[model samples]
Target: MTSTLSRAIVNYPNRFDPGVLSELPEHLQETIQRRNNVLGPGYTLIYKEPVEFVAGHGAHLVDRDGNDYLDAYNNVPCVGHAHPHVVEAVARQMAAVNTNTRYVQESLVDYAERLLATFPEELSKISLACSGSEANDLAVRVARYHTGGEGIIVTRWAYHGITREVASFSPHLGTGSPLGPNVRLIDPPDPRLAAPGSTLAEHMRKQVRDAIDDLERHGYRLAALVTDCAYTSDGIFTDPVGYMHGVVEEVHGAGGVYIADEVQSGFARLGDSMWGFSRHGVLPDIVTMGKPMGNGLPLSGVVFRPEVSDEFGRNVRYFNTFGGSSIPVAAGAAVLDVFEMENVQQRVLENGTALRAGLEEITKDSAYVAEVRGSGLYVGVEIVKDRATLEPDRARTEDVINDLRDRRILINGTGQSANVLKIRPPLAFTSDDVTRFLETFAEVAKDRL
Candidate 1:
């Protein structure tokens, strides 16, 4: 039987399928050739009609051919593409002074202070890194030191980062890759898997307990249970968010830490709260965030309890050359400023509510759409061959994605079968954008299905 978590994750294409790009325009063809020549191997573009974005503003992107596209697939530009506030802050800081953390930079300190304020008081210490991978790697180190354990637990198909150690914990990389000796895999808290009389919380607790037992049997003590709070890459699982409380307490009981990888769920992207962990009413011992942190600039970090870091600091020293440097720090600070100035979280709630309602109505009578669900701006439309059986339809999902691209709307499919359409738009996406997206989506669904 296919696990619920497996059904939720989209099977990312590893090899390029040339069939989709066969009829590209001459100009795009030439551009693709040039890119291939310069960019070595292992490159994959999103759509069959790959876009060479020349410029971006608000929630849209303009390709080299001057064709405009609604960019609903990018969250790195959470404040919208080329947001003036963040761009200006980065440029101004770069012009003034761009240096490492060794120097006394007031802006860096101020940004750290501002960012820390959003987190709970218990997470009093912060350490900046350049990407989600680095932050997570550091988090693993911190957990190991704090607990004197080598075991780590993650969801079966969880994706943490690209580093060697992190990759060992991310099984989604594939069967060819080997996992770390001390790492354990657990099924995500899928609501569908809950037994008739039990809750999702109970199912998840049992899963975590089983993982802990397995790790212990391997002669590895539990160090941490790292999870993507939104389960973004394992398929966006956001509902009855408080179900993970038992899992967290279980980690604590086993003397393991809970590390929340918020690369996809932080900074008001979830709409309901500032952090996804908060939505679940759980406080992580270590929280690592990236992607939207600097709003395009390279800035990610780990936020942890002061005492935890104190011990790590006493035993081992840590520093990153450009981790919390001047320019990225400035950009980070600007992101927070934009969040407040524009009232982003509340706006996300409004936009997400509208998008969800519209999607539910549009896909209600569809034969392929199994479910329409998600939180805030992050939405997923599950595509199935038969609504009654709920069997995934990857072929139809791929066709829908291409058709949406043809209509100038951007979205992608996710889940193990790549059957769920992911609709995570920028935080600044408006009511008008929502209507346009839904109209285009309905048109595409009608024509394709």
Candidate 2:
């Protein structure tokens, strides 16, 4: 059954409950109290029994008691936690010079050029930012300035970012963050939801058209259609490839740009492609990325067609104090270096295939596991009360997550119902880590499901 909890609450199924703080270890209890006092209630911890990690390397994290946990959730450390290359680059650059983009920095330009090379040739102009929210915010601004429209569209449960403009379209932020009057929401491109005798692409195109019509009815001209290519928050529907083509076509037909929010699905996370939008075979007018751009460093950027940004760039003076600073750029360059040196794309493809195969094998007999779907390393295991009805079992999903945590395997949930296990580990995750994760998950499923 679906959760009865307030939609305003962030959809984190494994969120820690403060009422159980007394049951935790004495040290943890003290730590929690201090955190609440200092950090306030704005931040929420995960897991039924919160974990305090002291150190992390590659795909494993070491807790205060020296207990090791396999990391199968965090994607921020795309190349691995504390990777020496990124660490050394950031340190070296920080020691040398950490100036803003105002100063002419060769390394900064070099990093930008390298990053732009990964995208389609048309998306050559880039604007740097400190976070995904900032990148998406800039993207929206550019789209509105270029098209002179106020309307924006996104999936019903999409989580783009936290900036005021971006969050207004990011419905996954929950009911507490009201959507802007100019924003409209549509269902993710789920093939299962296609109507009888219709293809997924046709279904998505119709949805976009309907949203556009509604926006017009409300006196909002279409500015852009933004989406997280991975559909991470809408249950990770990454199948029936090339389905986004029709959706993009519909947006373009309405004189609106398509913004690919690749914060979670970019940088080879989806295995076969360097960016998630490439998998759909449709080029986005603007692309925003972050989370893993500088490994752990706060680096994000928006790359768009030069024509799309020309009006905005000429009229607006954009400057982020730390956006294209030398240190973060150096860290970003190092991340690119690792991708080339380690052949990260190929590794992700192989590892993702193996991981998905193992999970499918283990959960084949499970009544709770309705499906295992994703591209590359970004996977989602849908938990349902009944396989036939496909009713989301959020409570069972929470049990699976907490049980896996007890077994020292880290994972979280996503989707509108918060019933899909989000298995997105660092790109550095290896075959051995995959095996370990599957073995533990199998045991957890057997015991709990």
Candidate 3:
């Protein structure tokens, strides 16, 4: 059993190192040098070999050299890479006109109406932005203004975004990066990993209350509790559905808003539902979504309670230059249209169920495999050196990931120790993709672990 304390304090190790590019192909080596000179060291690449892809089509990516790798890791192109529907919509819109939000755009309101319909009635207003970081920044400002408070709560390993304001909410950036003085970190609920006799619901309530109390003790008013619904950066704990209800209640009781960061978990990524917060059976005061909204395009925003937005609108003059503009609007509308016409939610649900089953079966035959858990298409496979001790096998995890990459199967590791394989493919991933992934994964597990 995983202790709550251990889970909260777990350190996220650096998974990819640019130094490993020593044995890279000559072209990639030259590309890396160019990237270092132009893009700087801040940018990161995946895999030991560091692939340079040229094109992607429906759950598969073609590298610069024409090698096709099965993509089991990218969620930004939610529906599928270069999906004709989204492509056509964006191109058609751009060909006609692509302007700022100040213009009268029916597509903007149309997309907003379609998106707002997906949320609970309370989340009746929308404000668009260019990325998740911007949406989260807006959410924090709205929360602070509405509650007249400055404190924020987040999971110890949570990652909201990269902007200066949002980065303060992302503790996963590690110790060198200081969180805002008003920010507090809490442990997320994990049903599969909680220690014996410890109920996740009760533990979460206690932790939330303690966090809020700590905030007040520090002379800060409670502004909001922001959480990524899937807990993606906090190790993908999606089990024990409705576990978040208690936390939400605590936030409301404290007069603080609850902001659901659904950038990685929204758009039917979790299956059966279009949004991750829906899985917890609790509604947030404000919900932020991005990444897949425009299917690879730069588009993100927040949807909040009408009253909250109304109040903010009256006081603060808020306007994003390119947000909710022509191209993103058309692309977002086409994504919604594709979801309806293609029944993406139902398909993802079915595929996810099959994936979990396959992974669970595979775990039984592997010594390094400790657990296989997730909802919809976002899954995590825990790699451990000792199943009895639950000690993470980071070395083995890295080996498996690189080996899979070598075999033309793309995936990555996540969690504090980077020992849990993060498997989130495009929504269009089919049964064939699953078979290929499982077969390749099993081979790597056997050979490397």
**Against the true structure, candidate 2 has what lDDT?**
0.91
For model 2, residues 1-449, the per-residue Cα lDDT tens digits are 12333446656557898999999999999999999988943488999999999999998899989999999999999999999999998888878889998899998888888889999899999999999999999999999999989999999899999988888999888777789999998989888888999998889999999999999999999999999999999999888687888888889899999999999999999999999999889899999999899988999999999999988889899999999988889989999999999999999999999999999998888887889999899999999998999999999999999999999999999999999999999999999999899989888888766
Ranked by lDDT, the better of candidates 2 and 3 is 2
Give Cα distance to truth, residue 277, candidate 1, Å: 0.5
Index of the highest-TM-score prediction: 2
Candidate 3 stretches with Cα past 4 Å from truth are: 1-16, 192-196
Poorly placed runs, candidate 2 (over 4 Å): 1-7
TM-score head-to-head 2 vs 3, winner: 2
Q: TM-score each candidate.
A: 0.95, 0.98, 0.95
| Top lDDT model | 2
How many clashes in each structure?
6, 0, 0
Worst ten-residue run, lDDT, model 1? 1-10
User: Model 1: residues >4 Å from true position, as ranges?
Assistant: 1-10, 13-16, 19-22
